[model samples]
Target: MTTMIKTVDVTTALSDVDRFCDIPNARISGEIFHRQDIYEQELEKVFARCWLFVAHESQFKKAGDYIATTMGEDDVIVVRQKDGSHRAFINACPHRGNKVCFSESGNARGFICNYHGWSFDIAGNLIGQHESGIYENSHFDASKWGLREVALIDSYKGLLFANFDADAPSLKEYLGPMAWYFDALFDNQEGGTEFVGGCIRSTMDCNWKIAAENFVGDILHAGWTHDSAARAMLGGAVAKVSDFDESYSVNWHGHGYEFAMDTVGNVAVLGESALNKYLHTIKPSVAERLGDFRSNMIGSVSSATIFPNFSFLPGQNTIRVWQPRGPNKIELYTWVLVNKSAPEEIKEKWRKGAMMTFSPTGVFEMDDGENWEYCTKTARGKVTAKQDLYVGLGQESLLQETDLPANVYSGQLNEANSRAFYQFWSDLLKAPSWNDVPNRNVGRVEAGAAAERCSLKEAK
Candidate 1:
């Protein structure tokens, strides 16, 4: 039986959404994190319409190779065709609605339905049927019965994404100023970066936003939350330094970043010979291409979130996609990123670092997972859910429009980014379309001028 969801008054929700901008130093109500109705609303208003990261193009290297991925809760299969082009569509077979391909990843010229012998080409055309006579003289056009395609699909520097809303902005436009930072991380090297093998998949009993917010906004927790792990990995001076505060910045469209000094020198953790070799290989090239500031960040520790649900810590060489299963659960897809032109030994070391720091078995992952689960459990309580949670760490200190690149933050410990994320989140849940977002909250101050400089209108 289908459960009926009562329609929320969009106008009333719009008022609530606009209020988030004014509540700079206030706590957000905890109810937003646990309500089932709100989660349902998010599925339609946010997830369905947003440009979600699907998979890297490198994942589909050869023609016929494909990987099953998720956009919101919808299952999609991304395939590389004989012509070396790519396509993505709902994984369901049109005839019987059965999942056409069950494997997580593989190579296939076409997907054959297991229930009935209906088959679809990698391009999503229903080309074959077991019993052609079943339809007889009936007017059935196989062309009209092709697998459903995602309304909007595009890529950015090899990363593919799809949106259910056709009117949504192009992927590049949606990425906005975040692209500058992405180019810093991805395009600095000659061949750029590529995912190593497949992702490490795991499930967490926590709200998806909890994990995303942690990556995007909660740098303060690193020292305390991962104290034991940091101590175990690098003892004495490194452990002591890890306890110190860091600096953070918030970008428009809810993207944010937190940067910290090398608590342990790069040479100490990555080995002297290896660090020397890496510097020798990239220093001259980096200086020639991106200048000193970006080249310097190559080995530093930085965690960042790209609006909505994609995040990466380039210094750690880790990338994550948070797939919300429901309000109380999330499926995390983690990939190890390696400089495409790095020496095999260096790439291997980077992979090991990623596994040790963020994989499901990693010490830090265990620490954060426990906290995420506890947060969700606490929110389940009637009294607790009624209260609000604070995220106003350095609201007064947030950088207003300045000469620095887009909302350049002054400190590493501010909650300005977290607040920006929630502000966008609330706006998304309320507005009927992405175009309506700017007008609904026009007077609201945007800390990072990044959005204005890299307008989504130009992404296409």
Candidate 2:
């Protein structure tokens, strides 16, 4: 039974997308977090068109190793091919849309549908089907019945990303200015980085943007929101605000990074003496390789997000993807990363330290989960949903003397990156195609003009 639907004008729909976010004034309407219609459109515009983090290269050591993951609402299977490269595909069987891969992860030669016995090889080819000889139509081409492959798959350093839009820019180009900053975390050492422990999965009763916006540029919440956890982890002092604090909040193409110049602030929070010691020992070398700005960021009290939903902590080394479950829920997938050249003991310490601090039962995670839940739950109120949330912390604070790329602003407390994030998000929601989306980062920062606008010292 096919149902025909009449088309309605979406001009108003497109026009209203930017209304939820007032970037100039740094006010975000609560409705964007809870609206069903906007959430549905996000699936098509943001997740479907962006390069989303899917897996890590270390997860697949041998041929045929695979993991079942999600790209927005769609189930995807990322596989390690025999050629030492990677490939990903939609995890649904073409026969009747049944899921083809059941396990979360494992090494398998191929995927077989539990229903109808249709099977696909590791390369996503239709290799077998149940007893196909009887009354096979000439039109039934086995070659055409294969599982659908993802449009593109690529990696940055060791982290893998997949894109569903063939028209989308390549991962490197899409990463843009953010890629330069990524080197501060991923390229600090020569041996490169690898995921140590397997992924830890949990669910949060919060809008996906809520969690992402936190990592994007919400260090202000750290001092107050996680005060107890910080005390437990770092002994007496929490992430307190000081008049002389030197840090930066930066964003480009929607990606955000906020950090303190104090190199061991976050590393000390891990409560691992050896790990903290290790960072101090390597700080000089990292500085030589990546420069002072990036090297100082290596283990600083920093939080960053790569556009839509990929986030990580530099010193704590916890990488996460906030996979959207619905408008008001997100499935959080987390992993611990360490440099391959680091000592084995350090790797083990990081694995356990991250587990204690950021995992499901982690002290920090518990506090964050509860808060984001309340944030989402309260927004459902008719009156509350109409309220506007302020994100104008550092609206008057732009930096120019710094060598950091893209929109550089003052301190760990600023909401500049958060505002930029919402602006890009709104742009994506409204743009009809990639061509329509504007590159706001171009000419965003002119050193001489920015330096005269506001000094970091005066802003603080």
Best candidate, lDDT: 2
Candidate 1 regions with alpha-carbon error over 4 angstroms: 1-25, 239-248, 261-281, 400-402, 439-460
Model 1 weakest lDDT span, ten residues long: 1-10
User: Which is the leading candidate under TM-score?
Assistant: 2
C-alpha displacement of 311 in model 1, angstroms? Answer: 1.2
In candidate 1, position 356 carries an lDDT of 76
Please report, in order, the local distance difference test score of every candidate based on alpha carbons. Answer: 0.71, 0.84
lDDT of 2: 0.84
lDDT, candidate 2, 206-281, per-residue tens: 9999999999989988888788888988788765654426888888878999888878788788889999899988
Provide the lowest-lDDT 10-residue window in model 2: 1-10
TM-score of 2: 0.93
